[model samples]
Target chain A: MALSFKPIKPLLHTGTNASSRWFSYIGLGIGVLLLLCSVQMFINIQQLLKEGSIRKDGFDFVSITKNITNETMGQPEKNLFHADEIDAVKKQPFIAGVSPLLANDFRVQLSAGNVLPFSTDMFLEALDNDFIDTLPPNFTWKEGDQHIPIILSSDFFEIYNIFAPGQGLPQLSKETAMGIPVQISCYGSNNTVTFSGRIVAFSDRVNSVLVPKNFLQWANKAFGNKERQDASRLFLKLKDVNDPQLVRYLDAQHYVINRDKTLLGRNKIVLQGIFSGLGIFGLLVVILALMLFSFYLQLVIARSRQNLELLLTLGYSPQWLGKNVSKQFVPVYIFIVLAALLCTQIMQWAFHHFVMFDRPELSSLVNWMVVLLAAALVLMAVVTNARLVKKLLHGLG
Target chain B: MKLEIKNLLPTYFEEERKSTSEIWGKERSFSNGDLVNIVAPSGTGKTSLVHFLYKMRESYTGSISYDGKPLKQFSREAIAALRKDQVSIILQDMRLFEAQTILENLEIKRQLSPYHPQERIIEMARQLGVDHRLNALAQNCSYGEQQRAVIIRALLQPFDVLLMDEPFSHLDNANAKKATALILEEAARRKALVIFAELEKADHFPATHLYHL
Candidate 1:
């Protein structure tokens, strides 16, 4: 019987190749997943920031005032911010725009129908209409309009609900509160004028009762006060309150931030820092995994060096042998990328459905960015593996 | 084809402290069908001579050529071609992969050129008394069995020259005779030159010439 020549399998290196190749895929898969999720989370946070609704504490705006020491306390007028100080604050690189907090020059009394039935003293604050994020429709007023639109602070209702229950007064919802008409009496310089005020919206950004800037300006002039409006509070539009230079500038000016607003601003920076830290950690894991993979490749190639030399002596070209060595890793690279992409997609679905149930606009799974990340990982694996294999083969050859 | 060695000297042999031998600096030549026995003592350069001829060691001075052409002038591709098609070697260590079976070790050579039929390989293995251990790992075989396996593997390639370094060092008389017969059969079929190194005279192996190292 005629027998055929048999081709031999590499028995010496097969055991190691089978056992070690999966670890590279697992490590790379984890690294790719971590990096993809972090980048996805970053995109989600950025989207929330853009929508301006996720910020429970306002970060896009800052409130500043002159430092009130014991000495300045005695002279209340001296603690107020001046024009040049406001200009100087505006000159700071972080400041995008600056608006002074305008106050009504008169005292006011409000009475609801059979509700309060008594005149309660009230003060009014105003800001530019463009600054309020939740400005309701028809929130502005003209001189001929009798009903003045008001944006009540959420804090005011929190305080009212505390006491209104004990007083036997019916608790008011925001809609019911908006419908209840109130009579306002403004008394300043012995001249009294009454205006009808109705609640239009509630504000979370600004912490005081808000009237339209146009209404405030009209009321201040009509109430018989004609003076250079000196503002005691300043609302600052900041590009980024986290900027160190802005912090340093504020510190040097002996100016104080509104404690509530400052805390919110700092929280944003801390949150962003945490996200960035996660991104860096993911990158480090990838680098470490890559190094480990390279080490494994080197070891496998080295262990088989004798066999490889024998093969070369048997007339096998280095390129042919190197290609055979590298071919084993190609499947691993493909599997890693596919597994990572699948994992990221699963995570995205879970996050979108469970974590972000209310926010449907955000992505639920692996987006374009995750795909790009997978592509990048595949490229890195191929290029790095090719280079290492070539170098090892060259050394052997 | 003819192989020529002229004014050949290993680099370390030129140093004053070492023993100098005439064969280290001698000119030698080999042609087709010439079975040249290199008989020498223990410290002679028998293994080095085999290594140099296989192009594994390049630390020797002087010229080595094939026919009339300098071997140094051959490109890497050409040298690889020559190794596959013209020259074959049975190393002193056998160089058989210990992890592979006997037949698989033979296939390493057989598959490269696909020169020998499997029937011929099986017949050769039977003649050497290793056909039953063909599927056994080379490392598990006895020394004589492995030596015979190496001889069979070396003959699987087509060659104009066969370099055997202590090829039968571990073989008994009967198995050595069998291996010598197989080597001579292949050499005569190809009309090839066989240069073999041995400590003592191999009267069983017919040789046309002999050189003392």
Candidate 2:
């Protein structure tokens, strides 16, 4: 027959200090709950912030330029990005890709011939096709093509519409503007060349009159003062908009980008700091609770020291006694942690339903990392309990 | 199995006192199935000799070895195994869990090694006149009854050597005779060695060898 512990149970006085044992249990449960909740909340906040700023194209693009401060205001070259400076920006870990906006070096004029009978001097810029928001099939040009296609900025169009009525010019809709053809004349040092220009698309991404990169390059080479010019602005594709390194790098270089996006990044840093502080506080609570449990274990063993010595004298190995004594508390540790996990799950579900209110970013259940941490905590408790019991029993020997 | 004791003397004994002893300051050997008796008055280190053989205390000057291996060299687990399988003892003080009943005390030892069947516990208790007191708490029972229970507890396990330290001090002549009859019967059944220690020789126990401590 197997030796039953029923006879041995009464020998060791583990039932002493009933209230203190329960207090430790409650403290452990609360500590576990606090830790898990902090982790879950951190994950939820990160998900919500990430979802709020994600672009429709699933890529973040920011336009950056050198600050035109009072010291460098009159020197145009200081505002332009040199080749080495562009390479340095491209080398940043946060930036996935970089594209420079090429500006026209020669003079250009846009004239509505018979439709509106309006003409204006304009600047043109071109960038890589990958950086362009809208790409129509005809937005391309070759060496022999006489027709030029252009993408106008929606903001520029809106500005023109707002002032057209007061200036005695007819306001045009997008469809009406696409139906009209205008003449673009490029003026060089000795001659002027004319081409028929058509509006192909409007972009909300870039605030410029954009043409094909190849056409701009050819035009600058043929009817320009110089071969190439430095880029005045750069469009950078970033991996994460909230990357603090990007903001710090930009600040160190005295560069400027969209303020609205950097403001969100700054808020993320502050929120992350707050959540990390809460997590550390929770961890401290867990450590304190574990120390309390260790004291309880020591009290029980110390009270029963004589009985344990007799048990060891009766050929009951210290190993056996240690294993059995530690086994008694395994259920308590597992139950406390599991109860905390259930509470975290309920809170997450309520948070998702009532607080977040179907915000598609967060889930209704706790994250898997929280569950793994709870498991790790249980293992830690069991191992610590066993080691302490073994040490105390070995002292008796 | 063999037990070898070489110049064993309790540390409390002075060096000049070693010359007046037989088992102390002299080499001795005990083998399997060799029944022996140790007779000595009180404070003569009879209990100390029992403890030294059990490896319970190390306050001694000389070495004691079991089966060619020294007792002090055994690990905790090895000592536990030795006590559980090869050696059993009835201490001068009956070390029973006082809060537990006599039956529980006997059952704990019986279950530890289980040399005898469960029915044998009650049968031996009846022979030693402790059957009626089996359910009584050890502290509540008389010393004579508790001593018989301790004997039953010691005989419940398998052993090649039995160390008894004044085992019948509380028992009357009639009760002691019954307890000795049961112990000798069990020892003879196993063909085991019995090392019985007492202040005076009991005519009932047939020891093959005798020693004066």
Candidate 3:
């Protein structure tokens, strides 16, 4: 005949604290639900953050400069980044690549000869070719080349258009501007030189007059002051623009960065903190519920001590008693966990459908990690209950 | 199976009691099919000896070994196994789950190690004159009825040795006679050893060996 625990059930007398037992079960269910929801929300937030951001060149290319403060007034050296500072920025784990924006060490004047009659003393900057958004094939120069190619910032053109009509000049389009020939006058300490410059392209990234690196190097060497100059700005390519460590590092060094890039990083830190707090709170509740259940177990076992001892004396092994006692709670634990998982799935579905408006970035189902955590929780409950029961039974022995 | 006892004396017993005891402070052996009777007055540690032999207590001086394995050396699991399949006991108090019915009490022992069919419980209960009280809660039954039920419950499991501590103390002459007959028949069926510890020798039991404690 198959052995049955029906007779042994009444011998244990676990039916005393019905209210406390139900309270523990309810607490366990709520704890599991909170933990699973926290994990699922964390996954959802990560997915949404990853898919929602826009990238111009498949990566964030941001320019950073030292913050100008009153303490460093009239000190140009403090405003510039030396080679060591550049190397340090390049060595950061979040930085993929770094290139300094080399500024013209010479004075320059530009004028469109007859098309717009515009002349101004302007600063020119150059960096690595990879950092430029638009690089035409003709935007290059060699030794002793007089025809210079220039890329002007789109913001500069917009500002020029705003003031063009008021200044009694023609409102030039980008195509018309690209065809205009301009004169570039360079002044050195002793001599002056002139080159014909043409606008080859417009850049939306760099907010300064951009020239080819080779042209800038040649011009600065031949017609510029003979003094080494540190870079005032650096263009950085980053693996993740929202990396909090990058923001922290830049802030620690008193460097100014585009706040729009690290805004998501700040929000992510707060979101992660909230979710982690929730997860920890859920874990504490789980532990407290288990402890309460353990106390209930102790009460039951204590009350049934004599009967259990008699049973043991009658040849029932402690292992058998423990297994039987713990087995009675297995189904309850599984039910609680599965119910919590179901609740989490519904919440995720609702979030994906109602809160997120059916976005493709987030799934309607809870993450598989939540399921794994639920399984682990069930195992933990079973193992804990069995161990406590065995220990108590062993004490009786 | 063989039970060996050497220089066995309860640690709580006075030194004067050991000199007159036959089972304590002496080397004794009981083999299979030996129906032994130990007679002792009240406060003589009769129940303690039964407990020691069953490995329920360890506060004793010498050693008791079952099949050359010392009883004290038996782990909880091993002792449980011995109780389930090798040794059985009937306590003087006739300990039972007070809330459980007499039939349920017997069913627990029978399910642990079933030596007979499920119907044998009812049949044995009937033979012991407690079949009518099988469905009643053990706490509600008379002491004599509970004692008879305890005998039936102890016989439900298979055993090579049986320990009884004043098992028939509550039963009257007729009921005690019935219980004794049923216990001896069950013991004989397995060719098992029976150690019946009591305050006085009952004339109904045909014991092959006798000792005084």
Per-prediction DockQ scores?
A: 0.20, 0.56, 0.76
Task: List per-prediction Cα lDDT, in the order shown.
Answer: 0.77, 0.88, 0.90
DockQ of 1: 0.20
Which structure is stronger by DockQ: 1 or 2? Answer: 2
lDDT ranking, high to low: 3, 2, 1
Better of 2 and 3 by lDDT: 3
Which stretch of 10 consecutive residues in model 3 chain B shows the poorest summed lDDT? B9-18
Q: Over the stretch A325-355, how does candidate 2's per-residue lDDT look in tens digits?
A: 9999999999999999999999999999999
Q: Cα deviation of A225 in candidate 1 (Å)?
A: 24
Q: Write one digit per residue (lDDT tens) for candidate 1, span A1-397.
A: 2222224336326456644556765777788778877777776665554554334334477677788898888784687777887788778777888888888887777777466644568888899876776799878888878888889888897787778878766688888988888887778786887878888888877777888888888888877467536677888777655553566577788888855544434555566677778878877877877787887888877888888777767665566566667766788788877887888788878888888785757766567876887888788888888888878877874
Tens-digit lDDT string for candidate 2 (B17-60): 57877789889898878889888889999999999899889999
Each candidate's interface RMSD: 5.1, 1.3, 1.1
Q: Write the residue-wise lDDT of candidate 3 on A249-353 in tens digits.
A: 998999999888788877876887799899999999999999989999999999899999998899888887889999999999999999999999999999899
Q: Could you give the C-alpha RMSD of every candidate to the true structure, in order shown?
A: 8.3, 3.6, 2.4
lDDT, candidate 3, residue A340? 95
